[model samples]
Target: MNGVIVGVRKDSQTYVNMKRKACAEVGIMSFDVDLPEDVPEADLITKVYQLNSDPDVHSILVQLPLPKHINEENALGAISIDKDVDGFHPLNIGKLAMKGREPLFLPCTPKKWHKDKGAKSSCSRSVRRSNIVGLPVSLLLLKADATVTTVHCHTKNPEAIIKEADIIIAAAGQACMIKGDWIKPGAAVIDERSQRPEQEIRIPIEASKVAGFITPVPDGVGPMIVAMLLRNTLDGAKWVIGQ
Candidate 1:
């Protein structure tokens, strides 16, 4: 199977490199398309279309946080649903939100880890409502018959809402945003925020003391996300091959 990654910016390059390594480990041919930070939105969408038509490329992923000038929705929408291994297309998300409907592929971040960790029946709270992770995950939890409360920036008494959850999925990009006091004792915490050396604590160390289970920033949800992406890519390839 073949996969193509389109990445912009330094951090995106770093992420793309990790994905390429994962693809290589699994014997999936990986292709890279690095566009300049200043590349026009039209050009980026054109690149996606090119990959979409390539029968050899079974999966196409565009690294997130494209340049400020680019429209993210337009770029994601350009990817063919068959090859949208990242599962960000509007149609995919639309299907995910409805009852008795399934998207071609579930977004990687919201797919596997929770089930593996046995959080399906837990009362869950998803922090922040961003399309990338939080919103989709909340939808998944609801589908699993888990009661879900979503806490966003506009949420009043956020701590009170959070304390009631049996499981928390924290993806608010702000470092140390969810304090120890905000978490319920013995609750499971999945910290999905990415970390940098300068900002090592996405969830404060104190929160770990209070929570029964919490994922460390660098080594935890990050690797699982990549694994699910590879899984989705492999599934797409199998579908193409009539498996």
Candidate 2:
């Protein structure tokens, strides 16, 4: 979880080599699961259940959009919630919606995490932001310890949403969406612009250097997001064992 942990793949030799190198560096062992496209739904379910039952299998993930006949809902339901690190467990959803308790697997995205973890905290302050994308800025606001009351876009009152955040994460791609006066000034102004013009790159905020930890344009959050997904996979494995 700490270092760059990548999946070792059989598809491409390059990925396999990269994964092996990473494994060797960290003294991690690689497990090979037979990923046959031709595998039947029952067989796939059986294999997934096998992994769920295996103590050595820290996590079991039946990749999304599995073979058409696999009956995704049925297969997913068959997976033990404790092992459903992807958080597909019906029980997890139940807990999230009803109990307001932590799901067996929580989406690590900042905003999602905040909504769950920050539920108990009071919304003491507000910061308005226009985001290029909605979730990222909401995540930044959550990370900054600001509980977002509302999130809106150009179609709605962009300023109104910004006015709500104590720190405005101005991500709405509209150039110059937030005026200088719109912000609390010296309040966190996270402006995410382009770093890689060819690609839609996302830079994250460095909480230490910036006004108070902002998700910069194309750098910070994306990398962290990958790491979190990996973590969620590991946690999902743990959840299955609990069941």
Candidate 3:
């Protein structure tokens, strides 16, 4: 898949080498770009769209951590939904949130005029973490075919929202964000980065008593998302190839 790696011009050498070396071993095409000069957010998006619209190009990835001045949200919005292998397109995000209840435009056809095309899904809800570490929870629930709700460091009334979820995923990078007291008592809780610094750490509260099928802090949901990205890429390639 041809892709333009935006935002990291000179520093992109390492990642390009890495992608080539890694994908070459498996005989998969690794496409890219390296925006060496610091550019405006719109310019970065324009470059990505140029490559994204190319029929020969199947995927587009803007290497993230773009320069501090660039607007990341807008640049990310530029990628076409069908080729959103990184899974950041708003259209793809909306489609995922719908859980197949709504129609997003497939690559072959125009669909979904405005945001109001679908019925409500058995929607996912969010949990609160005290810190900036709850980022990976969405990646975990994406595997369960559940959308992630955002109740993070800045959110208020975290306790009340935790009760609404069919699933609860917590990775606040804190010791424990959701105690057994805060949960719905039977929802699934996945801790994606529980064992990052150490293999064993005590949870602040006993969630297994309240939650159903709680993931272990060490080996639960972390590896699954890694596998999910690989599976998505492999699965998506067949569709791009019309197989």
Candidate 4:
């Protein structure tokens, strides 16, 4: 199996390295394309097109948080849905949202949480409107028969909405934003923030006392995301080979 990873920023490079390492361990040939932060959007799309046509490249992943100038939607849309290992392609997400239509691959972080069928019994998504995490996750929850309420930055009385959820997915990227009092007692909290010293704790310590289950920022969703990425790559390769 073969996969191509394209990344620009320093932090994205770190994630790329982790994926490359995982690919190696799984015996998948991985290729890297490191562009400057200021690389032109057209050039990036051109590269994606090149990979889309490469028979050997079964999966293509564009590391996210592209430079402010680059259009994230355009970049993600350029990827062939068949080769979109990150599952960020609009078509894939569209299929994921519709009933009886399965996406080729689900967004990895949400897919990880989706594995827990129990969590899907009832869920709430705390996220900004984005392709990466919030919307896709809410769709998945809806499919699983969970009533999902998406609480974003602009949502009024976000805490009151959050406190009613049985499961809370914290993907808002704000540190300590989901306070202990915001959680419903015994609610499952999945924190999807990237780990940083200042933001080591995504959900505050007091949250753990009230939350029945809470995932740690550093050790929780990050590793699962990489694993899901690899799984998606393998699945993409299998589909190509008629497996």
Best by TM-score: 1
Model 4 residue 60 CA deviation in Å: 0.4
The estimated TM-scores of all candidates read 0.94, 0.50, 0.58, 0.93
* Residue 202, model 1, lDDT: 56
Per-residue lDDT tens digits for candidate 4, residues 1-243, read 999999987677777898899999989999999999989999999999999999999999999878899999999999999999899888998899999999999999889888875544676655555678888988998998898888878898787888888888777766777788888888888877743343555688788888888886456777889999999998998999995
Per-residue C-alpha lDDT of model 2 across residues 1-243, encoded as one tens digit per residue: 111221222343343344335444554444545456666667767766776676665544444445555577876777766656445566765554443355666544333334333323323222233222344334334444556654435246655555444454444445554554444434444443432233442222232243433454555344444344456655544454566
Rank all candidate structures by their TM-score, best first, as comma-separated numbers: 1, 4, 3, 2
Query: lDDT per model, in order?
Result: 0.86, 0.46, 0.52, 0.85
Q: Candidate 4 lDDT (Cα, whole model)? A: 0.85
TM-score of 4: 0.93
Q: Clashing residue pairs, candidate 3?
A: 5-33, 9-35, 9-36
Residue 37 CA error for candidate 4 (Å)? 2.5
Q: List the residue pairs that clash in candidate 4.
A: none
lDDT string for model 1 (1-243, tens) is 999999987667768988999999989999999999999999999898889888899999999988889999899999999999999998999999899999889999989754565556778999988898998998888888788999888889888888899988888877777888888999988877653344555577888888988887566677878899999999999999995
Ranking by lDDT: 1, 4, 3, 2
Q: Model 3: residues >4 Å from true position, as ranges?
A: 1-26, 98-125, 128-157, 160-166, 171-175, 180-187, 192-222
Candidate 1 accuracy as TM-score: 0.94
Q: Which candidate should be chosen as best, given lDDT against the real structure?
A: 1
